[model samples]
Structure formats: structure tokens, C-alpha cells
Target: MAGPLASLKVLDFSTLLPGPYATMLLADMGAEVLRVEAPDRMDLTRVMPPHDGGVSTAHGYLNRGKSAISLNLKDEGSADRIKALVAEFDVVVEQFRPGVMDRLGIGYEALKAVNPGLIYCSITGYGQTGPYKNRAGHDINYLSLAGVSSHCGRADSGPPPMGIQIADVAGGSHHAVMGILAAVIHRQQSGEGQYVDVSMTDAAFALNAMSGAACLAGGQEQKPESSLLNGGSFYDYYQTSDGRWLSVGSLEPQFSSRLCDTLGLEKMKSFALSQNPEHQVALKKALKDAIATRTLAEWQAVFSETDACVEPVLTIAEAAEHPQLKARDMVILVDRGDGSQQRQIGFPIKFEKTSCRAEWIGKNLGADNKKYF
Candidate 1:
């Protein structure tokens, strides 16, 4: 079966999580994505901790379903060689700061001269023309600036989720992929390609569209924990019996009632007043007391029959081995050439006739140099 993006060709010059993940998604959808890495200084995640027998750790996971080509951009000869190859690709993605690519003579202007239909993408902490473009920032900074980190965590922690690189992976990669596809469509029509500058900060702002809307309607910035979506007594994570944690999302009255019925809180309906914090406290305490009486499995079984909107918080390992995941084939182990077969998250979107597959196998550094160059 032909993949949805089978005809696309992407040149991924960006490194680390954001760029690799974006290009990897394209590759998974059967695009010929070639990752350009430096011979000397590759992505930091390549050498970062949790090494499996001292091989590229996080890089292997992120770069799955993509080809790798080693090029020393600092070396004029190698850079020129890379520039020549860039003309053949449909899309080019780079995560460097504003002027780095232009300085290297491989920016959109340089590449578009050779291939007029090239879709060039630049992913950065800040946008190309922003005042903060020159400043160095990471995922945390982007989330912080975009108002994402403000309402992320529990009120007591006063900190966001320790994991989940919201800005880099979600905002950066997702935006880059969308922009690249959009540019491809536009280029097909106009036969002219333009530079796509995707700032992580701007992308991060997209995550809070609903919150922004609520703020606009109220004519005031919604306070943390006050919004219905944020941490309230109803839609929050709670500890279950046997010390396990589960998230409950019974925002609607029907769902909440169903959940209460499952937990045998149908009789404790007097404490349903969650409009005020003090009332929410009484409700939370009562719900907690009921949920603590039984194990997570018990609650799961009870909610399985209704639209309670509850889920046990599974760790990454547990999620990988989950029955639903296995039934849906949501995780698969791909051959990494080494002894180990790397586990990868499966393709998210499923189309009926246009089959989108995770095509390429895991590759090491400079794996596709011969094929790409």
C-alpha cells in the first residue's frame, strides 16, 4: 500500500528532538527523509545518558524511520556537497538560530536558487524577526513565554510536569510538520517556495487556544486552578487504592454522576457542590475516601460499563504493554541493526485507503550518506 506522504522528499538539517521528530513523522508516513548530521558534533541527545551498550540513546528513538547523512558544514567542500544535494529534496528543515544557516550558505535563499520549488523551514526558540530571535532559549523558556507552563502543574507543587517537553517536541515538531506539508501543497500550486519560520514560542501559544478564548470571554486572564479545565476537584489526578494514581475527567454532570455511581458516591451527592474551593475540598475528600476503598482494577471495571471518563495513570512501560495498545498495534519494535530492536510509538493517524505506515527502520549515524549524497 502506498503511504499518504510517499511522494514527498524531506531534507532534515535540524538536530535533536524537535527536528528529528518532525522529520521522523514525515518518514513514518513514507516520505524519504534524510537527516543531515555533523561528522564531529552531532545532536547532544546522541551522546546523552541512558546509553544502550554505549550507542546513540535518545537519537535512535527520535531518528527512527529516517536516513542519516554525515556532513561537516564548517568544511567548505562538505557544505557545498550538502548544498548540491539540497536541490533534490522537496522540503528542507533547519532548527538553527536566525542567521546560522545564511552564514553557512545553505539557507532558504541559497537552496531555493538551485531548486525553486524547495519548501524551506526554520524552527527556532523564537521567530526569525522577533526581538528574542538572537537570544538562546529551550523548551522550558518557550513554554514559559507562551503561558503554557503557568497552568501546567498542581497548585501545591508550584512546578510544571517534570517530564513532557511540551515546547520542543509537541509545539516545535508538530508545527514544523504542518508547515512543511502546507508549503508542499502551496508549492505544488504556485511552483514557488518560501521560507517557513516556526518559532517554538509561537507554536506553544497554540496549545492554549481554548484558554485564550476563555480569557477573552471573561475579559480577564483566568486564574490558575479556577478554570474548569485546570485543576479542580472534578478534573484532576487522584490517588487510588494500592497507592496507584488515576486521572479523572468527569467534567460534565452526566460523566461525573456516572463516576460517582461507580465509586458508590451516589449516596454522598450532598458534597457535589464544586463551585467554591471549600465545597470542592469536601467533594474531593469524599471522592478520595470512596476511591481508596477499592483497587484501580475495581474502578476500571466499574467505569468500563459507563462514560465515566476515567483512566489509570500508566507509566511508559505499562502503557507499552497495555492491552488496548496491543489491540490497536500502537507500539511496535523496529530493527535497529544492533542486537536490540528499538520500541517505537506507532503512526497516530489512520486513513482507510491511503495507508500511512512507519516505513524506515532505525538507523545509526551517517547511515544514509551513500544513498542521500
Candidate 2:
């Protein structure tokens, strides 16, 4: 059976996490995604460590279910080939500096000429037009510039690096996918396509809604660990006696009361979500002291029957085998074509009639050149 996006065709000229991830999602939903890479300028992710079947694990995961064709965009022949492909592909996603695609002779305007209904998406560090448009940056730089890091760290600790690439995935990849899908719907109605200019910094800044609201609407600058969602309240993480951690999110009055009751801290009920620093400190200390008396597993068992949002922090391996994730089939086995199978995180989008699939892992570079070119 065909998936939801089976009719769509995408030419993915982006590399690394953001664009690749978006295209991967599309491919999972049955889009015909053709990954275009330079013959001599392969994506850096191809060389990243933790290789499986001589392919980078990250690449295998991101480019799964997609075909690949190598083309040197710097060459005139490649330019002509891309123009021919532009007319066939419904969507074109690229990640380059502002003028790089234009200089390559495959900008949105040029491609739109070939295929007027082409959904062209550009993902960059900054936008196509800005003082920092041409600046080079990664996920961390974008998050910092967007003021997201200002409210992410502990009160006394300097801004620590995030465990994941929040800006790259959320700001660039997810936003680009949203824009492309919206444009797809608009094209269906108006028979016209538009350019989606996605800036990582812009997307990251937009995701700072909580802090932005405080600053813009309330004229308040949020400090790290001083906001309601940050660590100003009883909602935080606590270390257990077994040296593992558990997240606590008993924010609502009912949940807070339940947590206090479970921990035998009835006196701390009034300070559940208090903004006073003294109250916050006292409540946090009391909760931490109570939590430290038990192991992570013991606390998990204790909270298993409750509505309080408390859960043990699991590592990546543990999460893969978690009951909830396992029941949902979030981890799937892929054939490496060498008499061996590899486990990978499965597609997330679930549909009743047209479920997504992971048909295969990423192919070798230019593996589909003969078929496409």
C-alpha cells in the first residue's frame, strides 16, 4: 500500500542533519527522495565514526529509504542534468549560503522556470537576507544567537552545551518540512509554488516562545533556572541513591500535591510552584533529599500508579528497549544486504491506512546513478 506522500518526488541537495532528516521523513512516508551529492565533495557525515556495513550510522539512519545520485553542480553538464531533473521533482531542498545555489545556476527562480510548481526550500544558518546571511555556524551557534541557551543552564553553572542539536533539528529540519508541506497544500489549491527561506537562527528564536513572551509581553529578561519551566519551581530533575536521575514535572496543583504526599512532604505543598527563591530552594532541597533516599527503580515503581510526571532517565540503549517504545515499534531492524541486520530508529509518523516504512538503510554514494541519470 502507498503511504501518504507516495505521489511526491523530492530532489534533496542538502546534507548533514537538518535537510537529510527532513527528506528522510518524507521518504519514510513514501516520497521518492533522490539524494544529490557532489562526486568529490561527499557529505562530511559519510566519514563520521560508528560505521555499519562501511557506512556511517548517522548517514544510514538519515538517508534510509532514499535513492542517491552524484552530480558535480560546479560542472555545466551537471547543471543541465539538474535542470532536467527540476522539471520532474516536485520539491527541491537545499542547504547552502544565500548566493551559492544561484551561482550554481539552480536557484529557486531558475528551477521555477523549469517547473513552476516546484516547492523550493532553502535552509541556512541565517536567512538569505541578513547581516549574518553568509556566516557559517552549527547548531550551538544558532541556539546561542537565538537566546535559547540563556535559559537552558543551571543558575550557577555556565551555559552548558545541549545534549542534542535542538536548533538544527527543530529550527531547520522540522521547520523546513512544515514549510514544504504547507507549500504542497497551497500548490494543490492555487497551482503555484513558493520559496521557503528557513534560517536556523530564525527558527531557533521562534522556538524561544516562553522566554520571548516574557521579554516581549511582560518586559522581563529570563535568567537561567529562574523561570517556571526552567528550575524556579518544584519541576526539575533529582539524583537518586543509585546515582541515576529521575525527572520530576509535578507542576499542576493536583500533581504537586500527589508528589508531596508520595514523598511525605506535606509541608512543601504550599510552595509547589512558588516564585520566591527561598521557597523554591527549600522545596527543591527537600524533594532532592527525599528522592535520594531511594533508587531510581524504586522511585519508578513508587510512581508507576500515580499521575505525577516522574520517570527515570534512561540512556539511548535503554530507551530503545523501553516498553513504551517497543510496543510502538519505534526501533526496527534493517537488512544491510550482507547477511546481517541493523537496528535503527523507525519512522515516527503513524497513519492507520498508510503507515510509513523503513525499506532499507542508506545506499552507497551514487548507488542509483544508472537508474536516475
Candidate 3:
């Protein structure tokens, strides 16, 4: 079936997580994404992790649907070749340090000169211009600078790294995709392409909307896990005797009451209704103690009988084979011609009519050079 972005064509100049993820989003929607890569750098991810056929583990996971093409942007012929493809593509995505593209003569300005209707997006640690624009940093660095890392760990713990590339994925990849889509919409109406500069640090800060609002209102930044929503006694993850976890989200008074009633711990009823700061920890501990008394399945069986919002904390593996996932058709698998089929993080968005669905697996480096060239 033709995806919604079937007519969209993209030239991907990104290598790592952020840029490739953005292109993957579009490609899943049926856009023809042609990833451009230097044979040497070759999306270093391709070299990391679970691999079989001498291909980078990272390559097979993120670039399944993408086609590979090798080229040297430093070569004048490569730059010229890219320009020729620009006129035919609807979008261009690149993740390079500021001025790197301009230095190579393939920046947004140069590309727009070829196709004015092109939707060009640039992803960087900082935007194309700023006091920190030229500074070099990675996801954690950007998160630290943006104050996200400050609030990520436990309040009592020293600085700890936040797992999962939040800055690269949320700040860089996701933001770049949104910007590119918006530009595409604008281009359709105005027939004029524009440059999209996605700044990771700035984007990281944007994620501080809640913390920012709280801080603006004179709230002291607290540790992330301490947040009422994080895993307070009422809405926290409790470890059962079986070493499994039961995620309790009985935050609301009614849900808390229901959970208390289900736990048969009516003595802790008032704790659920307290605004007193001291009660937060006690209430959480009480729930934890109660939950720890049973196995994960026992708790699941208990919570499943109650209206208290609760569920088993399943791993990605468990979630893939979960009844809920099957009911919603969440896990999607595809054969990438590597003997074993490729598995991926599937799409969650669904449109009522044009329901958004993941249409392809990721691609390898420059996975589509011939198709584009």
C-alpha cells in the first residue's frame, strides 16, 4: 500500500541516530529516502552491537528500509552529484557541525540555489548560529547544558548519566523530523523552500517545559525520580518477590483509594489524601511493601481485578509478544536479507483515515545510491 509520504523524496546526509531516525520516520511513511554517506565514516552505528554478516549491527537496525550509496562529499564530483539530485528531491536532511556544510559547498543556501522548493533541515548540537553554535558536544553534553541531566537522577545521588539518547532522539531526531515536515507543508503552499536548523541543546531545553514552568513559578528543581509522576508510592514501580516489577499509577485519589482497598491496607487510606510532604515517602513505601508481598503475576492478578491503574512493567521483548501489542499490532517484523529478519521499534501513531503505520524496516548506509543517482 502507498504510504502517505509516497510521493515525497529525501536526500539523507545524516550518519548517526538523529538524522537517520528523522529519515526513517519519513521513509516509514513511504518517502523515498536516499541516505548519502562517506564509505569511511559509514554511520558508526553499523559497527556497534549485534551483527552477523560483517555488516555493522547498527547498520542493520536503523537502515533496513534505506538503500546504500557510497560517496565522498569532499570530492567536487560528489558535491556536483548531490546538486544534481537536489532538483529531484523534496527534502534534504543533514546532521553536521555548524559551517561544515557551507565549507563543503552543500549547505542549505547552496542546495536551495538548485531547488528553491527543497525542504532542507540541518541538525546540530547547537543551531547554525549562537554563542555556543561552534561548541562540540554529544547528547549527554547537550542535556547537561540544557539542565535536563540536572534533574534526571535521584535527588540523593551524585550526577549519573541518563540512559537512552534523549537529546539525540527527542531533541535532535524527533525535532528535525517535525521541522522538516512543517517546512514541507509551507513549501507546498509557497513554492519556496526554507532552512530548518534543529539545535540539540536548545531542543533539550525545550523538553524542560514542565520544569521551566515550575522554575519560573519559583519551584526548585527536584530529582527526576522524585517527581510525583515519576514513581511516588502511589504511582511507582514496585519490585515483587519474584524480582519482577509492577508499575502502579494510582495517583488520583480515587485510584489511590482503589489501590489501597485492593491491597487491603485500609489503614493507609488517609495517606493517599495527604498534601503533607512527609506523607509522600511513607505512602510510597507502604504501597511498595504491600506490592512486594506478592509475585508479579499475583500483583497483576490483584490489580487486574481493581480499577486502580496498574500494569506489569514488561521489557521490550515482553511487550513485543504482549497480548496488548498483538491486539494493537504494535510489533512489526521484516526480512532484511541477512538470513534472519530484522526487528524494530514500531510506529505508535495511528490516523483515523490515513492511519500512520510503519511501512519498512531501517536501511544500511547509503542504502539507495543507485535509485537516486
**Model number with the top TM-score:** 2
For lDDT, the strongest prediction is 2
Candidate 1: tens digits of C-alpha lDDT, residues 188-295: 888888788898999999888888776668665755576667875567777888899878887677777777777777864545545776767777787778788788
Over the full model, what C-alpha lDDT does candidate 3 score relative to the true structure? 0.79
* Total clashes for model 1: 0
What TM-score goes with each of the models?
0.93, 0.97, 0.92
lDDT score, candidate 1, position 146: 89
**CA error at residue 318 for candidate 3, angstroms:** 1.1
Q: In model 1, which regions exceed 4 Å deviation?
A: 267-276, 338-340, 359-361
What value of lDDT does candidate 1 attain over all alpha carbons?
Answer: 0.79
User: Of the pair 1 and 2, which is ahead by lDDT?
Assistant: 2
Clashing pairs in 1: none
Q: Rank the candidates by TM-score, best first.
A: 2, 1, 3
Write down the lDDT of every candidate, Cα atoms only: 0.79, 0.91, 0.79
Clashes of each: 0, 0, 20
Q: Which ten residues in a row have the lowest lDDT in candidate 2?
A: 333-342
Residue 105 accuracy (lDDT) in model 2: 91
Stronger candidate by TM-score (2 vs 3) = 2
